[model samples]
Target chain A: MNLIPVKTRILQKNENLFLFFIEYAEKNINRVIQENSVLVISSKIVAVSQNRIMNILDIENKESVELFRKAVIDEADEILVDKNKFFLTVKNGVVIANAGIDKSNSKTGEIILWPENIQEFADIFSEKIKKKYALKNFGVVISDSRVTMRRRGTVGVALNWSGFWGVKDERGTKDLFGRKLEVSTVNIADNLVSAAEILMGQAAECIPFVIIQNLDSGLFTNIQQTHKSAEISQEEDLFQISSN
Target chain B: MNLIPVKTRILQKNENLFLFFIEYAEKNINRVIQENSVLVISSKIVAVSQNRIMNILDIENKESVELFRKAVIDEADEILVDKNKFFLTVKNGVVIANAGIDKSNSKTGEIILWPENIQEFADIFSEKIKKKYALKNFGVVISDSRVTMRRRGTVGVALNWSGFWGVKDERGTKDLFGRKLEVSTVNIADNLVSAAEILMGQAAECIPFVIIQNLDSGLFTNIQQTHKSAEISQEEDLFQISSN
Candidate 1:
């Protein structure tokens, strides 16, 4: 696998997503879009391109120091942890810090919310990229930076993916000794995003896009199956089971 | 960043770690060991090389369907969840399913435990690799597959790392609007492991080793800091705060 970070100008608010991609491709002259390649776009860029941004001053009330609180609540499906410093919210069935509302890299007093209908946007973006590149097989993953439950530091996770299978199930498959393997599904999309982050720095790098080439094409035969396969039920959640 | 899976013969029990790496390098003829490169080794391989294998038959008694129950108890630091179908345990300050004792890929009726003193092994491995390649700066990360709190499927996480800073701290750093960024540490090692998993398949594919080149050498100047920086305290944990 080869990962090449696509460095572009600091994307302006409401920048055309297609033009941004074109500019990135033109600047990084060596990176030719290949068949069966995966392109990773930061969720912040997606939100910025869609103009899904908010100003802190707009949401603030005269009496409260909780300036960003209202925005977090408005976007969250469930507010799991409301601490003095941060809020862990469930949005679109994913629990994330600050509801995945990025404050850094935003214009002064402004913040970037997650792109509305992320899955749909990813589907459309994938279609456009496929058409532009004229590739038979492609993968597009929208990525968000996040911290894990017990681990320190943030890594990238796949918020939405299109054009390929995102998860690989190895259940009912035999191990080396022929014993049945259980609970062996792999999150292929999230893993790809993690790799892409090595090049995409947290701040000031302006490399919001990444191109990943040489992925196996066989796993992406049914893109719809990838979306469904990556999701887990509440009962199967290991942390939830332990919390109970 | 270019990732190439170093395919080698299925590692045998009690295999010499150094010999195993040599085999991997020889097999992947094109992937030269570059300076400032990172090598990712799966935790399973480390455990197997360390001879940390246990037969389930050895732990079970004549009575009680203690299938893997005894092994889980023996390996866990704290058994958080022990239900009919699964067990979530905290071992070595990390919460993981089944105490990170892998059953799949082991011999029939046998399982592989995490390598004893993973950090120490990684340090030694890094030193050896650096000497062999004659590189002043190198990175070695030992990784394990894990599922997140609410997310489906497994992604790679860093168990231990050496030769480079694994965490990038952005605390107190200014954002684009000059606002101080807090709670923004980045997991550099975990992201690398996640990318390495692209080539390292869950089963059948014997590509357990990966080489990542073209990383910034400045991050590796102080290797001692890398080990200490990645460890998070219980009080600072987001999940712990909510659980309390």
Candidate 2:
């Protein structure tokens, strides 16, 4: 596999990211990426592009805001209020202050929710790329940098995916001695995004996109969808929590 | 990030793996890799190569096994007996049978302990790889498949590493908006290994060694030498006991 860092500019607060990518990939992406290659995009860029910014002032000093503030102060290690009413936090293994609220990047002062719809966005983006490039085995991954509550720093996770097999496994495949494997399925996108995130640094890498090639395209099933958050629970997480 | 699946046909139970890798990489590995690129090896293969297999027959019908059996039978979904001594659980997220005992893959039916010294072996492997290829920036990672007590499935954890940075970012770096990033440095190697293991399926895909390149070498640091296990108290673990 070849790791091609997508050389894109740092996203601004209210920039239109989808249009930017359409123009950039058309002009700048290398031709070497065959129909079988995969493109990985940071979820932060998607969130920013979709205008999912939230503002704290607009939250109103109501019961919800009061409760939220109390929770923030109690749970978060650090918090900051940007000029645009955007609250940021390095808490609970996440960087989005106010849990990904925004107002500066949205139209008007209202906060745009997490992409209005992430699955729709991923499908549209994937379709556009496939149609434009005439590629059959291409995939688009909308990734986010998240912190585990107890673990340090951020690792990339696939918020939504398209044009790829989400997982692969052989539940009954035999081992070397002919014993069958009970239940083993690989989360392909999550793994790939994590690998690529190593190159896409959090603060100052300027790389928002990564192209991974030479993957086993057969592992994909051409389904575009969003992963359920319910599958991951704080209670089941071991590395993040300290058993004091 | 190049994924080169090193193909080596090992005769069943043949313990020596280093020879197989050297031969396979020299022949099947592509030329695109720089001589200085690093080779990341999973820990299971290392254990297997070190002949760390355990059999059930060797373990006497002792009190420890009986006690562990009683304690785990209610919790374990399925129990597997191999060679009469080792008792492996299907999905308990714990790799050790009889609370981590056995001796199958060692000489004369003796349990070859978790690599006599992991870091030392890693260092030696790193030096050999660097010397053979005349490479300046290369590393070796020995990974193991471990199940955290409360989590689902088996995820690969870094057992030992050489010629690589284990973790990056210190506790006190500034965030994008100039706020101090307390406890933000990430465990780059462990996360990467976990991601890679997703593709290196437990039973199906026999690809042991994966080549990782184009990573920001600046983030690389010395491997973590400590083997301190996390102390999890029954009360502190939210999932340890159910009140319902």
Best by DockQ: 1
| Candidate 2 Cα misplacement greater than 4 A, ranges | A26-28, A56-114, A148-153, A229-244, B11-14, B30-36, B57-116, B145-156, B170-183, B221-244
Q: What TM-score does each model's chain B reach against the true chain B?
A: 0.90, 0.67
Q: How do the residues B85-125 of candidate 2 rate in per-residue lDDT, one tens digit apiece?
A: 33444322223333232222233323323444667777888
Candidate 1 docking quality: incorrect, acceptable, medium or high: medium
Predicted structure 1, TM vs. truth: 0.93
Candidate models: Cα lDDT each? 0.78, 0.54
Determine which window of 10 residues in candidate 2 chain B has minimal summed lDDT: B235-244
Positional deviation of residue A237's Cα in model 1 after best superposition, in angstroms: 1.1
Candidate with best TM-score? 1
Winner by lDDT: 1
Chain A TM-score relative to the true structure, per candidate: 0.91, 0.68
Candidate 2 structure quality by residue, lDDT tens digits, A16-52: 6666776565566657556666778876677767655
